[model samples]
Target: MPDSASDVFDIPADVLQRETARIFRGHGLLPNDADWVAEALVEADLRGIHSHGVTRVPIYTERLARGLFNPRPNVCVVRQGPSVVSVDGDNGMGAVVGRRAVAAAVDVVAETGCAAVGVRNSNHFGIAALYAEQLVAHGFIALVCSNAPPTMAPHGGRSALFGTNPLAFGVPAPGERQILADMATSIVARGKIILAQQRGEEIPLGWALDPDGRPTKDAATALNGVVLPFGGAKGSAIALLVDILAAVMTGAGFGTDLPDFYNDLDRPGNLGHFLLAIDPARFGERDRFLERLGRYINMIGDCPPAEGFERVQLPGEVEAGLRRKHLSSGVPLSQDILLGLRQAAGHADVSLEL
Candidate 1:
């Protein structure tokens, strides 16, 4: 659900962060873990990806309270080889598991020049870009993949059999931001449709199909149906690849075996994620690599704009721009979403005025 200025309320990032952490802490998460999770969600909000931001607080806290997700778990990292490791999240919060996994990857990458970390038994980790950005900040190229609960159908099939599996990649770029690409394989993330449904808004055609396999704009119907994959077969194929690496290889649930994060309260999500990090200096001089990468980025940026479009922008450029602007102004939240957040805060006995 896209937000318009007329229907939004601005909350300063720092204030939102404090309140969100309080809510999580009130719900039983350890103070440090709650703070980290709050920062992660707020970072997404600052970047304008509200679907994965604070809007998720209600469902997340609900699941936590219901004991569907672990508020605290002993995340274990097992080193399989010189550069390979495995993580067992013990049914922990996905972002918490992801934070630990990425930290292990960073250490491995520092030791071996590259790392491959497989994670299992985790819940929904919001925004893969968070880990990618962290790796990029360490001057390492990163590829992050996560297998979610199934929401999309296999190519040519009408049943929901595939996750809107997401993939993210990031590398250090000249100046401020990294060259980052993060996306769900579906035509749109299921969260957007969920948001639309929550707001009683209609979705766009081609985003999903009704149960009868007919295209529909009704968000509720779409949720009952299946989301379409982007680029049809191509996206479906990529989704399968992500599932293989993130779920199958990591010993997590796949296909229908994966429980829905929103509807399945009886079991843990048992989701999986894979992270790969490569130090650029592993192959050549770090300065030379940076210089060449800068030149390539400049070439892309200087490309002529196509009709109805501005000059070429790197992947994540728009989100980065929004982040900078929102840091000073504030993150925008729809009225409905704000109300929901407040209600969630109340449930945890945490007062939230924003």
Candidate 2:
């Protein structure tokens, strides 16, 4: 349960997971599938990434009720080559579909030492890190990517043409959490804009441009505009690379063909995803690779910090730390989300027990 603070509650991780799983099941997902999706979103929240957390349950359930996606889809996998696989999600929930893809890739790598998996006709899969994390656990280095609806414009171009395509990587390690990096090519995720708009907050300039391609601070306006690409043209190029691999190769809808999940509730996203799993044993001794990987993480943390910062922080370190703290201290959630959860529970016929 959350505390008596100002419109805030600190829900425990297990409680949230149980309740969320129940809601998903009530919405037509099988028990196991519901649990998987619940874990994905709850993990995002535990890592302090509120943008991809349970706040999404409302919209997701609404879409579910509208029959935009298959609550129980038959995710089919086909071998493309000796070590390549392709998956058709049947318009399934991204979390469920992504897990199936990663699992298939891991299985292929188990037989071939390396694997590439392409996924198509899926909906918005949450964080890309989840798949990478899964592969790393199976002793494989992993790269994952997904294409989103249009949010970012090509460098020096005016309207949106490319998605805020995201990529993630996970390196294998023995005594460490492994090196994990997940990022959207855009300066920020559009979900952050939606969160800001809900909070009546202003967005930072330079993060996005208005519909006319001018910088804007209003979160709602910025959302209606184009999100900026990170590192200018370089990031735009990376985003294009992601789109080609995740969309073109996977045969999913690309660029603007994919409708926004929020704006067009009944339209299936038909998103694309890609995953690569490489065995460290193929390069050298697995033990040595793990040792070196752990060394690098320690060295990075040991570096002295610049002014205004206490120490160097790795890409996933902050979120990992937040996860550890929240697991014991309870997950802090806003009242608005709590209320929405209540509504979602009612719609799905799940008991929130608030």
RMSD of each: 2.3, 1.7
Q: Which stretches of candidate 1 lie over 4 Å from their true place?
A: 1-6
Per-residue lDDT tens digits for candidate 2, residues 1-354, read 445323676889999999988889999999999999999889989988789899899988989999997999999999989999999999999999999998899889989999999999898788899889999888898999999988889999879888989899988765645577889899998888989999888999989999999999999998888998999989999999999999998899998888887888757889999999999888898888878878887888799898999888777778888989999988888888888888988997777865
TM-score of each: 0.96, 0.96
Measured by lDDT, the strongest candidate is 1
Question: For residue 195, what is the lDDT in candidate 2?
Answer: 90
lDDT of 2: 0.89
Which residue pairs in candidate 2 have backbone atoms (N, alpha carbon, C) closer than 3 angstroms, thus clashing?
2-10
Worst 10-residue stretch by lDDT in candidate 2? 1-10
Q: For model 1, how does the per-residue alpha-carbon lDDT over 35-149 read when each residue is reduced to its tens digit? A: 8889889998998888899989988999998898889989999999999999999988888999999999999999999999999999888999999999998999999999999
Question: Which whole-number lDDT from 0 to 100 does residue 62 have in model 2?
Answer: 89
